[model samples]
Target: MSDPNPSPEAFRQMASEYIEVANRQGQDAYVGAVATAMLHAGARYAAFVAASNSPNKTQMQLSRKTNLDQITAQFRTYLEGHYDEHSENYDSYIKR
Candidate 1:
């Protein structure tokens, strides 16, 4: 017996599904990746917003931490490794 969702890819798929919905009126892929992590995998409520004319992510939820700490650690690793929007893996996951 095993936990099916113990892997990051599994979490990614689940979170990506939620993100497809999130993207209906949502953020672009980079921040969307972060948002998906925050919302689904991290299992925490998240809000994504940009500062006035700031192209960079200058205002993110830095202080808060997910109660699901293990999932959050894995999700953060997944995020750093796959930050590029054009990555085929990410695109596939995002569309799925």
Candidate 2:
């Protein structure tokens, strides 16, 4: 999705939909919600890196790929880097 297309409200709506789906579906809904959320979150993260003029898109992408808490002690932590932070990342370990 393009930066101009993803308004703040759209982001909020995506995040909200993830939660709503998860709640309605319970643990069973986690996989789908997390995956969708992670992609969305990753896209936003990549955009940030792009806007910040990051010299390392690969690293930014890798940073966006890994679990936040798993890498927190290893790398500076931020949102989208973790499961809960990226509710769509069902396979990643979420920070408690």
Candidate 3:
């Protein structure tokens, strides 16, 4: 079976690719709008994955709350870490 837990490097590379796409969109797009679009895309893809893994619609519905909670918690943790890092270097980040 494949590893249950993937490496941080794998995640970093995926994140970098996402960021690169956002960067390539150019200054014509508002950063907040782009971020919102990415968030929506993530949510839609997550729902698709959950549905795909379930044997039936009822099973997917039954697990929806659990899946949502897990995803929300993971997002919170990631957001907190990034928030703390930015807070630590607020001056430098703001200047960028």
Candidate 4:
């Protein structure tokens, strides 16, 4: 089965939800899941933008390895920034 294609906002919400879960549960597994969700959302959005920019009307490859790698890196950096913010407010989340 194919994964549901989720919007950027969907991913953001997922990340937030998972982070809260992680804090509440105090589980490393939930932390990983949250990060994965954030990265996937970022990558999906990047791929959508890349495909929209293509001029070809015919069937074309939507993703190349290098391009995806670059996109993932950018997304990782963006996710890390959010993670930092979450970490800062982690105590509040845990208290919930």
Which candidate leads the pack in lDDT? 3
lDDT of 2 at 19: 61
Q: lDDT (0-100) at residue 22 of candidate 3?
A: 86
Candidate 2 structure quality by residue, lDDT tens digits, 12-71: 897798668656655665677766776677667756745465457676566554534443
Clashing pairs in 1: none
lDDT, model 2: 0.60
- In candidate 4, the residue pairs with backbone N, CA or C atoms under 3 Å apart (3 or more residues apart, or in different chains) clash, namely none
Better of 2 and 3 by TM-score: 3
Question: What would the per-residue lDDT of candidate 4 be over residues 1-96, giving only the tens digit for each residue?
Answer: 534687889888987885586566545456667656755766688778777765663432644666678777886897799799989999985666
Q: Score every model by TM-score.
A: 0.34, 0.29, 0.86, 0.43
lDDT accuracy of residue 64 in candidate 3: 91
In candidate 3, what are the lDDT values of residues 25-82, reduced to their tens digit?
Answer: 7467988898899999999998897888799999999999999998889899999999
Q: After superposition, how far is residue 41 of candidate 4 from its true place, in Å?
A: 5.8
Error of 1 at 52 (Å): 40
The count of residue-pair clashes in candidate 1 stands at 0
Whichever of 1 and 3 has more lDDT, that candidate is: 3
Cα lDDT of model 1 by residue, 1-96, tens digit: 558447888877976886586566455457656665646633533223112223444333332343236446766986776675447567567565
Q: How does residue 26 of candidate 2 score in lDDT?
A: 53
